[model samples]
Target: MNELPSRAHRPVRVLRVLASRHADSTRMVRPQDFDTELVAQAASVSDVDGHERYVPLCVDWRDARLLLSRWDDDCAMSDVPFLYQRQRRTATHLLAVPFEQLDAPGRAARMTPTFIFSIGRCGSTLLSRLLAAVGEQSVSEPDVLTSVAHFDDDAERAAAQGARERIVQSCVAAFEPACGPAPVIKLRARCNRAIDVFLNAMPHARYVFMCRDRDDWVRSSSRAFGDSGEALAELLKASVEAFDRMHAARVDPVLVWYEDLLADPVRALRRILLARDDLDARRAAVERALRTDAQEGSGLSRASLAMRTGDAGALAAFGARWREIRPERLLREHGLSRLR
Candidate 1:
């Protein structure tokens, strides 16, 4: 029999090495856990604009598994899964695998994760939760993307490109299904201002822009924010502004109404997912989500908001500003031209 090739000459299994090293425990990050030379980088970052940034991350090439670590100064890592956290007290020899090293292109080549941009107080959380039930990965609110969206200057723009890869890695790490689509990233309402920034980075990425009907939106928002005049105005402005930017960027997003989704969750989800072949594979997961009752769990559901009659009054107060912004384009984009 021919002699086997020397281990040194053989292809290095990067992902397997990282996973095996860290399999024993989840504790302090270990340098040896990563093939640093392959792609040496840090996983720690400070909070950006009061939002927690993702800790440094990398991908293991051997098994193609993603890895991340809790940074000493990063508070955002506190809420992440226990494996990613640094448990200083325990005498565990947890090796921190550098997840940032493996920023290889097309890691999630089969599926392009969807982006869900919504008006606040809509049923986005519920929709995200439902998607999760159907084997879809959903990152509801992350700090890194928010910071990336605001990038305008040269340095910030370059940084946004790197940040985009890391964000994709984070989603890769969060994804658990053996063979499903990429994760859905649901942006906070505030990020609506920089929606184009994100779209520019992932040009082919599909998106869904969700909103409640004007009346329901005003009512729900007023209940959430008591002094609702300015806030309500901003909400409407952002909703319209997002569409304008989408049109300018030529980012065609499917518009979903909260009430319509509630009425028929299955069909609504299918309409959104069926937009792409990869997403269509999640049919079973969608079925499971349909059966799931909305409740106060996993930060997905909240007690239903009571309709506030004062919503009409609040809208009246912002009448001038509201009229100044043209909503006809948005109305037509979502097939609500009849409203226009």
Candidate 2:
């Protein structure tokens, strides 16, 4: 097995050093202030001619900066199971742009993008891959949006609301030149907390909500993460509440259940497609996508997750615990009686 790095050389410590330097100075970072080799690998935003190849990987909210990684092609981005993993593996040089300086012209007027929100373990990744296979520019789980979702400080988050919204808009716009006319973005499961920010940023965007049955979701989550039954129940509770808010919102989202999606994926695709003019042409692509594992090379792949021993007793306990914390009435109110 590969040995872990020493504590002093860990990523968290390195980030802390950078953050300390950033916090102390208002001026732009200089090569001498940090590791020369690392600085040499950083790119200036102005040096890049086009935005299409640069993807927003994450946000350093403390310093109010967004990190963009350069991707060589769409294949480099889409082939990976998740955008963050692609960044970790292939991003040799990065561009850090201040939130105030980031801009995408005509962003407000551009055709609204499509969003895929889910409670996870619910075929969202499969849907994303299927869309990509069909020639759609499907972006799966970009970290920047997740950062915004888990900003953590209420006062700071409230103060930076406008900047946060702009960052969200700019990040979406950055993908347009290559992924347009409408890029479909699949958000991380926890990202639903900031769903309002996305909705407010792009009022006209289409939304698709994906979810699975409560018992299956809890079981899958527990098995995938090896977490306790209680922990999984809490996550389920939070996720369902977020879904409830979105479902009751002014924008009507296309609701897809995992069972129904697996039953008839083409039907689900048809519902999500803005126009069915090319549905017939994309049918084979969808079938091909279904044949393959969407999370194949990622840590979350089925083969990788299968290495963990399943605990039947734990799953049974989760089912009993879920009943105690059940949102059955909430599901019924949102027309999710099927989930109940």
Candidate 3:
């Protein structure tokens, strides 16, 4: 004879039980899939029907947009376990709405996001990963910003600013719900070229520029760039100069060095998090980032190895002509770097 369970006990038992559903693979998502409450966030620009269109990367948190970049096509049913923890649902197929279909009201309500721009082969990726440990949705090296930075004309750049803001607003609506109220985006290093143009669009956005020791950067970049190593160094130098100028002018930007991050990543990250006012979970996130191999699969690490071992290919790429570009006058004026 078995005792009858109470209503509460039955519900608990039911929750503990596992069941599977046969989701229809052929089911098409209609316009009804999205609405003002459920809007798509701009993940990337794609070609649809021979015209450039915005694609939804993830769903906004109000109803939860599927983060497309995190989804794997082979495992269509898989969801980011960290995300949608309560829902237990994964987006098997994505539904992208026209740019005009995105919820305008939602975009206006989103928080301003942070930006991370760095010299090539710096610790930008590692910083992004560390930020993720703290539950921040970090997008590392997005191509969209790089493309936006290519517009050189002042008028054209000004025009692009509006479009850029709209895209960012959509991205914020989509990613912030999952990453944090303020999502952090790490743009391609080249975006440094158009930093002002970008900042104009999102005037209040927080930004950080990462750099490395001159010798270290030169050695690392030379390995891959060959004859262009000097040019790469010049670019890095220019970026640092521009960043220093901004800092001197009272622009709210932070300058981070590769050496400092490597020596004490937790401390380094804490500085940025504190500056950004996102220090919640700093202790646990720093611990997790430090406990794990932060530089796993990092191309920068590989380049450093090549430089140390004196690989012939690396030597050839780096070439024999190593030139030390002058640090920006602003850096010297501000006493920013120890590199002489």
Candidate 4:
């Protein structure tokens, strides 16, 4: 089991698990107090008003400790072994997300390595390395979160390939002994469900949320966005809405800014480390240099020379064209403020 690195959350408490029930055509095993507002959506099969019930079943020490995107995803019932398939699919993704995908699978370390994430170019990779340096364990990038965030459900058997359940269980398996022995996990932003999973499953975990100035973030992301990549722009707009909801919900998230973390990694990380009592005496420079021996280890870089100096100034022009942009529509669809 992973060791507890710092003073963190409590252990996983097994709530009651439910068994199978009837639904349109599927089955799910739900936990006792599963609480995601989103009802389990029906499969893509048309004309299906209800899904076959897949009742929630046993809560393994593993499942009880992993991060779940939404508790409700665990609640449906079906004979199709959807949950098992979900876990398998997640495993595939965990093995293939940009950096983490490259790691040799099933390595036998005493503890599981840290899996770091964020949407593309969100500096999650950099943060992962930082944690890796500080701890004895290695770090992987974009694990389950990115794959799920960018999942193409239209692709056949996406969930089955991902193995959603086992992947989550694996993370907790890694986290437990790692936290106890060397305190490895120091991951950054995952989709909302990732957060839900961590909070529900890993009580001894400390989650970190890294943020950037909206304008800078937008402009920075626009750097490599292709003409057809309007989804990139929409993602930023959508995140703003999500952030607002999280803030209103009064979640006490640890906020780390991209600029601050980059400008003076030593000092910034010192403060972050000092937030934990056991880490107060940890030197900033030592912490900064721990896993990340030097700059540019995170594999992040500016856009290609062509994109950086392209004749088309469309990205830069977003600054001046805000009013002309249909930001209102974007925010409305994303359930966010009309700050645009």
Task: Name the best candidate (by TM-score).
Answer: 2
Off by over 4 Å in 4: 1-122, 136-138, 155-166, 175-204, 224-229, 244-251, 263-267, 274-340
- What's the TM-score of every candidate structure? 0.56, 0.81, 0.58, 0.46
Model 2 segments beyond 4 Å from truth? 1-51, 73-76, 104-109, 152-162, 310-314
Worst ten in a row by lDDT for model 3:
8-17
Q: What does candidate 1's lDDT look like per residue over 185-263, in tens digits?
A: 6766766877765665455677887888766666666665553655666666776678667767776778788888879
**Candidate 3, 1-340: lDDT as tens digits:** 1111122211000011132132221112222332222223333323222111122332222222222222322421111212221112333334433334344535535566778888766777677777777656676654434545554357645444435545445554555434555667786666777666555555566788888776666666555344265466457666776686466546578778888877876677777677545555476766676566444433334443565432344333333332345554656765555543
Clashes of each: 9, 0, 7, 62
Give the candidate order by descending lDDT.
2, 1, 3, 4
lDDT of 2: 0.68
State the weakest 10-residue window (summed lDDT) of model 2. 8-17
Scored by Cα lDDT, where does model 4 land? 0.36
Model 3 residue 216 lDDT score: 69
When sorted by TM-score, best at the front, the candidate numbers are 2, 3, 1, 4
Q: Model 3 off-target regions past 4 Å?
A: 1-109, 151-162, 224-227, 275-288, 291-327
- lDDT (tens digit, per residue) of candidate 2 on 1-340: 1111122211111121131123222122222232212343223355455445677767766555667766764464656678766564555445666554566535744767888998878889998998888777888887777776775577646545556677778788777766775888998887777777777677678888888887777667777766677766666667677767666676788888888877887788889985866877787888889899999877778898788665566667776777788698887777776555
